[model samples]
Target chain A: MSIKLEHLNYIYSQGTAYEKQALRDVCLELRDGEFVGLIGHTGSGKSTLIQHLNGLVRATSGALYVDGKNIYDSSYNMKGLRAKVGLVFQYPEYQLFEVNVLKDVCFGPKNQGLTDEEAEERAKKALAQVGIDENCYEQSPFDLSGGQKRRAAIAGVLAMEPEVLVLDEPTAGLDPRGRLEILGLISRLHRERRITVVLVSHSMEDVAEYVERIIVMNKGSVMLDGTPKEVFAHDKELEQVGLAVPQVTYLMRGLSELGIPVRRDVTTVEEAREEIRRLLKRRETCGQAAEGQ
Target chain B: MLRDITLGQYYPADSVIHKLDPRLKLIGTMVFLVSLFLSHDWIGYLAATVFLAGVIRASRVPFRYMLKGLKAIILILLITVVFNLFVVPGDVIWEFWVLRVTRQGLSQAGFMAVRLIYLIIGSSVMTLTTTPNDLTDGLERVLGPLRMVKVPVHEIAMIMSIALRFIPILLEETDKIMKAQTARGADFESGNLIQKAKSMVPLLVPLFISAFRRANDLALAMEARCYRGGAGRTKMKPLLYEKRDYAGYAVLAVYLAAMIAIRIMR
Candidate 1:
């Protein structure tokens, strides 16, 4: 489903001493089946914006339209939107309360009014999608390691079969391998299921490597929104907001500054490797021509 | 949703009551609570109302905000009112099947409600004006004499203060867990009593887990910092009775005397 936010603003503790505008006139639209990256530091309105999509948080002002329907209106069914737009919160494993992993994953589908058999069936498929083995299905979710618990939690949201998945910092506090595994799993789901995915994260490398469209927020406003290549081009501006471009982008820049002509927007090690190889080939050819002279 | 709870919250304002020594506030709250119970008639209640109104104004805490704490006890207030309006024996005002409304009952219920309301507001004023750290220091100092009798006074105060600090945090955590479950379509509302209780399983399990995790982390952190049961601990800002504290005590003593005198007049 397509999602559109028009001049959306959200203020926490409104009219109180602790009043804060968490979002300021953010306007954006996401087309169907888009892979989008929401980049921001902590408290940069990224989480607040996604929460609005599912109606978990209402915008303080402005309009949010999900698939052409105004969400904040009284007549709209918020539960339906929430079911369609599954949000996997940060540290979702803490929400696990079922006796077993499979049962926990089935909670969402059952809540969608599915029959027990159908709910279990959907839960099984979701568990498999997240690479959770059957052996772990009957075990207590608390018994699993951190990464496994995270996957089980994701499966809970996946079982709801949402058209759009919004994950807020899914790989936070995980080790490197676990982080890559979770990211890879999410990307695979997006590729296979063709669901619209909005990944909110602080890691520039992950966003650069995975998503096509990048939206960066700073101080409760959309600072930049474009393709990853376009956004990273303004790395200096990102730095001023306490954000940075991908490590590979810096590596490419360093290579270019050292007299090697390389593409500076390369975001992955593989892309950097190709750029370095191309530079080396040109250097060797130049040396041979000079020797011939 | 849970973020809205302002219980035990300190309102930062520069005011005379806010500047009072926390120990004095604590003692004053106790004195006020006792006086509220001792208050027998409308005169004592009036003295209470005047005293409470003055303190609340001095603290600069919003009146509407203080009333928010009353929301949680509305049911108890109603029940007390009902019981007091029917149960006490006196000249009957109204009669019905298995229930008799009496003058004494009505008056008793009215006094009970007033007393409870005053008790809550008086204590809330104390907490609202004092920061948790100051309260902790105040508690440790006031309860210091208990240490001579082999009581773990510092530890008790530390635990109380920590529990106070965690109230808002745990509420936020509970809210998060509730929202997580709600997103999964777990209906917390629109359920029968049993069903509502059952639905809370989803909320409470996560809350407990996170609470334990936080407690574990805190214990480790405290131990890492060589927190050895508060022994030999010296305060950076030791508790000292300012002239304001003495002045506060004088005001409280006068208020208490008025309360007792009003009770005698009735």
Candidate 2:
């Protein structure tokens, strides 16, 4: 399903002393089967924007359309809309309240009105999709390690089988290995399931590695929205917003500054290495010609 | 969602009330409350009201904040007023629909409502002025006598202090959990009573489990710090009753005596 937001604004605690404007006229769209990355500094409206897609937060004012229907329409069923767009919030492991993993994973599907058998079947499939072992299905979710609990929580959302999966800071507080594992699972799910994935993260590397498209937000507004290469090219803008480009991109920029012919758009170490090798080959040829002279 | 709750919100300010010894303020608040209950007529009530108004002015807490605090207890104030107005029978002034509006009842209700309002405002002023750490320190100092009676004064104070410290932490945790469940298509709003309660299972389960885990971590950390209850414990900031405390006590004594005199005259 495609999601579109137009001129959306969200103000928290309206009419109170603590009122804050969290989102400001943010407009964006995500096409079906697209792997999109959302990057922003803390308090930059990334969480606020995603919450609108699932109708978890109603727009204080503006239009939100999902699957060609106005999500904010009076006749729209918000619960059903949420089922279509799954959201896995940051630190999802904290939300595991069920005694066993299977029961917990089935919670979302059951809420969607599926029968017990059907929900359990979906839960099993989702667990497998997240790489949770079948034998651990009946184990207490609380007894599991930190990463396992996080995966179980994600599976709970997956069991609902949302067409658009939005994860907000999914790898926060995870070890390096666990973070890569979770990111890999998300990539695989996006590819094999053909579902639209929206990954909200602060880490530039995570987004640079996985997403085809990147949407940058700063201070309650969209700073930039384009393919990863297009957005990351504006390194100065990202840095001004207290966000950094990927380390490899920074490295490439540094190389370019030193008069080495290198692609500034390189986001991965492998890409940077290959570009460096090409530059070295040209240098070697130039040196041999000088020696021949 | 949990972030909207604004209880025990301390507004940090540099004022006389904030600077007063916490123990003095604690004792002074208790004395004020007891005096309010002892008040029988408008004179005693007026004395207490004037004293509270002075404290509020001295503390530099805006009148609007006190009014906001009063607004929270409006329902209870109304209940008390209604109960006192109808239940006490004396000097009937008017009657409508089996409801007798009497002079005594109306005055009694008015006095009771004002008294209760004052009570809430007075105590709220204490909380508003004092930080939780200072409040706990004051409590431990004042309730030290209770130790002889086998009361777990230190433990109770420690619990209160810890709870106050964890309020923001738990609120952030709760917000995260709610968001996690909301992402999973959990609908906490726009549902029937039963459905809404059922939906909370996802949010509550995670909150409780995390709380338990936090408690475990806290216990271990405390143990690592060599915490061993209140036995032989020393305070970093020792309590001292200054000349102002004596002056405060003298003012309270005079106020109490005048209230007693008013009662006797009545």
Candidate 3:
């Protein structure tokens, strides 16, 4: 299902001294089956915007539609909306409480009204999809290693069979290998399930590598929204908002400045590598032609 | 929804009450609470109400915010009112079966409700204006004489300060956990009492675990900073009474004397 936020605004602790506008007229659309990365500085309202997709937070003065249904409407099915848009909160492992990992994963599906057997089936499938071994399924979630617990917690949300998955910093606090594993798992899921995925992250490199589109938030509004190359092209603007282009984008820009004639907007290492190779090949052909001359 | 809780929350403001020594506010709140129980008459209540209103105005905290703290004790308030209204024997003003609303009962209930409300607001005024650290400092000093009797006053103060400090953090944690569980489709709003209570499992388990984790982290952090039971500790901003604090003490004393005079005259 596609998600659309129209002029959405959210004010926390409204009418009080501590009032803060966490989201300000945020207008965006999440098209079906697209992997989108949301990057923002801390307190930039990225979390607030994502939470609106599933009716977790009602906009203070705007509207949200999920698949053409106004979620804020009194008759809206919030539970159904939540089921369709699985949100994996940061450090989701803290939400685990069941005796075993398998049971914990089943919590979401069961809350969705699935029978024990059906919930278990879906839970097992989700665990396997996240690469959790069957042997660890019966162990307590707290006993699992940090990475494994994270995956298991994610499986709990996956068991709900959401058409759209919103993850807030899924790879935060993980080791290098763990980060790669989690990102790879998320990319694989996006590819196989054809689900619209919204990943909120601080790592610009990871976002550039994995997501098809990027949305940058600053002070509670979308500062930039485009393909990774298009977004990263505004490197100075990103930096002004306490964000940066992917590391490879910087290297590509540095290379172009040094007169290497590489594409300045390259966002990934692979793209940079191919760009340099093509430039070298062109140079070689030009050199041979000069020798013939 | 959890954020609606205002108990023990400090409302930051620059006002005479906020700047007064925490010791004075501490003693003042105690005196006010004692005065609340000093008389059951409107004259006494009138004095207390005026005093509380004056203090709240001096603190510059919005009256609505102070009243928010009363929301948590609403059930207790209702229980006390109901019991006082019906159980006290007096001339009957209204009667239905075993439930009789007595003339004296009516006054008693009204006074009890007022006292309960004043008690909450009066105490919250001190907390709302004073920082937890200052309050603990005042408490440690006020209770210092007991130290000679082997009371671990400083340690007790440290614990109180830590607990006060964690109130907001834990409330924030609870809010996060609730949202996380809600995102997972846990229905905390619907269903029968049993089901509603059952839904709390997802929220409470995470909250307790996170709280314990945080406590452990805090302990490690404190230990790393070489904290050794508040021994040989000097205040970063030691408590000092200002001219306004002396004036506050005089006002408290006058309020207390009025309450006592009203009780004795009655």
Model number with the top DockQ = 3
Off by over 4 Å in 3: A282-293
lDDT of 2 by residue, B68-145 (tens): 667667789989999889878998998889888789999999989888878778887887788889989999988999
* Candidate 3 lDDT, A144-215, residue by residue in tens: 999999999999999999999999999999999999999999999999999999999977977899999999
Q: Interface RMSD values for the candidates, listed in order?
A: 1.0, 2.2, 0.8
Clashes by residue pair, model 3: none
Model 2 lDDT per residue over A1-293, tens place: 89988999999867554578999998888999999999999999999888888887889999999888998889998888888999988788878888899999998998798999999999999999999998899899988898998999899999999999999899998999999999999999999999999999988999888899999999999999999889988999998989989999988898899987898899877778889899999999999999999
Cα deviation of A250, candidate 2, in Å: 2.8
Q: Per-residue CA lDDT of candidate 1, range B1-266, in tens?
A: 45545668877788999999999999999999999888788888888899899999988888867777777778999999998898899999999999999989989999999887777778778888899899999999988899999999999999988998999889888888888888888888887999999988999988998999999999999999999998899999998999989999999999998888888777
Candidate 2 Cα deviation (angstroms), residue B245 = 7.3
Using DockQ, rank the candidates from best to worst.
3, 1, 2
User: Runs in model 1 with CA error above 4 Å?
Assistant: A289-293
Please give, as one word, the docking class of candidate 1.
high
**Cα TM-score of candidate 1:** 0.97
Candidate 2 ranges beyond 4 A from true positions: A12-20, A58-63, A67-76, A257-259, A276-293, B1-5, B13-16, B41-118, B144-154, B187-200, B228-261
Listing every candidate in turn, what is its Cα RMSD in Å to the true structure after a full C-alpha superposition? Answer: 1.5, 4.3, 1.5
lDDT, candidate 1, A1-293, per-residue tens: 99999999999978666789999999999989999999999999998888898998889899999999999889999889989999999999999999999999999999899999999999999999999999999999999999999999999999999999999999999999999999999999999999999999999988788998999999899999999889999989999999999998998899789977798888877888888888889999999999999
Q: After superposition, how far is residue B136 of candidate 2 from its true place, in Å?
A: 1.8
Model 2 chain A: lowest-lDDT 10 consecutive positions: A12-21
Ranking according to lDDT, highest score first: 3, 1, 2
| Lowest summed lDDT window (length 10), candidate 1 chain A | A12-21
